[model samples]
Target: MPEITVVKVERVAGEQGQAGRVVHIERPEEWAACPECGVISTSVRQRRTTRPRDLPYGEEALHVRWHKRQFACKEALCSRKAFTESVAEIPPRARVTGRLCRAAARRVASGASVAAACREYRLGWPLTHRHFTALADAVLAEPEPVEVLGIDETRRGRARWRKNADGSWDKLERFETNFVDLSGTGGLLGQAAGRTGSAVEGWLDARGQAWKSAVQVVAIDPATCYRTAIRRALPHATIVVDHFHLIALANKAVTAVRQRVTRDQRGRRGRSVDPEWANRRRLLRARENLSQRAFTTMWNALIDHEPTGQILTAWIAKEDLRSLLACARQQQPRSVISHRLFRFFSWCAGSDIPELISLAETIEQWWPETLAFITTGITNARTEGTNRLIKDAARVAFGFRNLANQRRRVRLACTHQTINPAA
Candidate 1:
């Protein structure tokens, strides 16, 4: 290998009665330069033998025996002592050769587990993983500036409840916030622990003002903390709330209204026989997904079984909100958006149902962000897809207990190195 500068392949043969091929190697007898004094050294200090592991060859593992030395400084005037020689492939104190690490890490980048790499290389887990990380550290690129960035969170660990001194239990939720490049090929930029505003701001602050200023828009869910952090860190960036989240909120409002109506009317939860329970999933579905017969069946059943029309009101409000969102795809004409928004507001206002009213208030609260979504039509779909890949990486390893290693593996998995490695 080019990484080995001084070593020569002296012999490659199977020893008597040995099972595998043994490759004996040694440094050439030449004057070596003194590392500190810049003088040549010829005095011999000591000699030792090392067997650094290398990539497997053929069916059996090849054994490498390297005969190396420590040389005494030839310069008398230098503050000279002795030092061991090293090559690029075998750094000082490295037991596993560099090329072996690259081969194992390449396997990992191609979806092989670290344990599988370890078995193939016949190396320890720590050494194999360190090599994997070294290759990744060399390969991972810097976060490039992008016009649009998407932010989302995923669970970092299992949820737990810790009891306080006063006998109250506090939830301990672990999460990691993922920042994605929405306008570029950088699938995942970076990740930060926790889902708090401080966590978001801390990561942004490290990117420096120049990087933050280049970001013109950010797509995210309707998390107040995320918005607060973005405003503090990127004041110029237009925040576009994902339209999917708003639709989910509308569905959530429908469910809340149905549950409240059922409890109030029957003084208990709805059973499977109840029309409200039967139509629960249908109410959350988009209008296009249901057939006319199915819709008619649900309508007749709910109308006949329930005297109060609260569930119907919530469903109508949901459809109105959907129609309003659909205007975003109509090129967001001002007149069209105003008409749709007015119609949705009129429906919510006419019903005066607490659930529908609350949904309207939420729409009004995030109206500017909603307008940004309509105008730009940028969604957090990329970030959502990246989150799936991230979760898949977690599953491939079963799970990760250490956050740092997990992030390394995830970053490697999400934005795998495409460029060929130099030998």
Candidate 2:
């Protein structure tokens, strides 16, 4: 049997000696190649003692006391004549083992804030952030783009800053856009400059035209910049205007009508007022939990009211709401929807409300895409889910004061499949 050597290793708490252990080893005189330079190093210039941490065993931690050596390289042209040895089992420049460092990196990437990850893993904040960044960069090197891409922008950095007692401005928010794959259910494809058309173009340029050509459908909100990019990059693919944005616009109209009626009613009741305002408020208040009789009373009041400025404004506020409800009540038969939808579509297109009219014209121009929802059944729900994920990532990273880091973290958190920590 080969002879064995045992070295006395001490487990100390915070620079003070506590408990100790004897680590068994064979061939303690072997030297490793320099990490910085690929040259093999053999000669030990001097012995430098180092106290490194290890996994805990029972109530005590396993510490490593090794003699670090400095060696001279044989290559004359090499810039480095002398270099120090590095241990593969241990992390680079870290006192802990490779496994512990990787574990810390995983926690930080898995949505734990730097401070929180530090507290839980007993790591320094700077070290955790650095490891996470390195891991994220590795992940970004490999990517898998999917077919159905959804592109959208979000407000990041707060536009308004809070004033401090020192008369300095404190930034509250920042903004960016995320290009994602709705079909494959992966994380983000790429992050953009900002919520502008140029940003979308920049992201597409980075991804290359091959990936963009594979896109069968591009879903987005009513942003012209995004639409223009989709047309330029994915000209053949259908541009689907998410149904939820339309519904949200309609909901805005509903809420606005409710508020307007409520305010107008309050104003008229000062002495005497339009009977319609009172009835409008009552119906809006009973939007939920209304009994049949109550609904009937409000409906009758609205139907009988004279059509005037107040009534016209209130009804205009609710016309989109009425059209949607009417469409929902009708059967799916083309004949029935055609008769009802065209009227609603016309009302939306030609209406005096500039915003509503614009929405209608957009729907008219993209009539095929908009009406495809009735058959194809696509919605903005997936994109919304992705947005929520981005928000959660932002929260985990403690609101990304550094925009580049924020985008990097967003890409990592969303595109997890590309992540390879060991690489």
Candidate 3:
């Protein structure tokens, strides 16, 4: 076969000089075969001209025009009369060259929105979207095996409405469960309809026992639904409670105590001028991150002014909980963590704050999982990062009503690979 090259270049004659190059390319002299009878033919029945988009030449756009030859099939019994020539660079019947399609797909998969990719690539939305969908489908068809799975839920939209018993409308919270493979730079395994146990179990069960057996750990927030599903689907896998969720719970308890104490002491909700209200964010911040003198001054003032010591106690309890997590992450012995945790539990029990007591009990119930988290050093931080990307994509797209397409886009984005090479 002869080497093909650009044989001619012409300036497009128009009112304005367009920023592009129109290159006439030569076709390789190769024998064509009849598809029906597999007979080789050398006859050129006709020649046709076609212009297809190609990869940009520098900053300028590229237009590829090829004089494609049609060959006549010589086999007597062959049903086909003629067929057009195709090459790896430019497939048959395609409006764009293979390289251009790949470039567009790469741009879209690399975090650029379809509209942005289309604009930058000088392609229409429909064409760009087609390439993106094809790339996503090819790349995300069979997910990688998951060893450490992370399950979490995110609010996709507002609550759905349903007719109530009295003809009134009731709102039901809508959620989607994301299954992430945390064994590597996390890729989304799948997304289910809702955050229910059944939804999670169904998705897991579909992966079969081989996948379930391969899973070593499953990390999740302290959600009972997720616990139930993981227990049923991956019974052997250790469930590790995410440390961030534990800290969030502690913050919630602190907030609850503050609200209750404020209502009782101030006779109303806290105002901007109030010291505690003004330093609300300071109260939630980790002690290590806060300036010692500033934190001490605020702490002393808030505790001294309030007649009830509940606020101070709540703050201490919150700090103690944070300290417990910090200690768990340290290279200390397990006995040290156990001792500190016991102290934290005792403090919570004596604190007399209902919120703290409740939090302590919840922690006690999930103590094994918490300990597993400390030992295994696994968390849902990756899954949370993936969730943020999913939300960002949705925000950029002005929100997605079609869950299937949204899932595809997310899988493509998270995996950063093509599922189908043929596409």
How big is the positional error of residue 392 in model 2, measured in Å on the Cα after superposition?
Answer: 2.0
Ranked by lDDT, the better of candidates 1 and 2 is: 1
Q: List the pairs of residues colliding in candidate 3.
A: 138-419, 138-420, 139-418, 139-419, 139-420, 140-419
Ten contiguous residues with the weakest lDDT in model 2: 1-10
TM-score of each: 0.79, 0.69, 0.87
Error of 2 at 357 (Å): 6.5
Clashes of each: 0, 8, 6
Model 2 C-alpha lDDT per residue in residues 275-325, reported as the tens digit of each score: 554555453442445677776776666556543243344344345444443
Error of 3 at 266 (Å): 2.1
The runs of at least 3 residues in candidate 2 whose Cα sits more than 4 Å from the true structure, single-residue gaps closed, are 1-49, 55-86, 91-94, 142-145, 160-174, 268-336, 346-366, 418-423
* lDDT per residue (tens digit) for residues 14-67 in model 3: 336656668898676667767678788889998998987777766555677888
Give the better candidate number (1 or 3) by TM-score.
Answer: 3
Which run of 10 residues does model 3 get worst, by summed lDDT? Answer: 414-423
RMSD to native for every prediction? 4.6, 6.8, 3.4
Per-candidate Cα lDDT values, in order, are: 0.85, 0.63, 0.82
**Model 1 quality (TM-score):** 0.79
Better of 2 and 3 by lDDT: 3
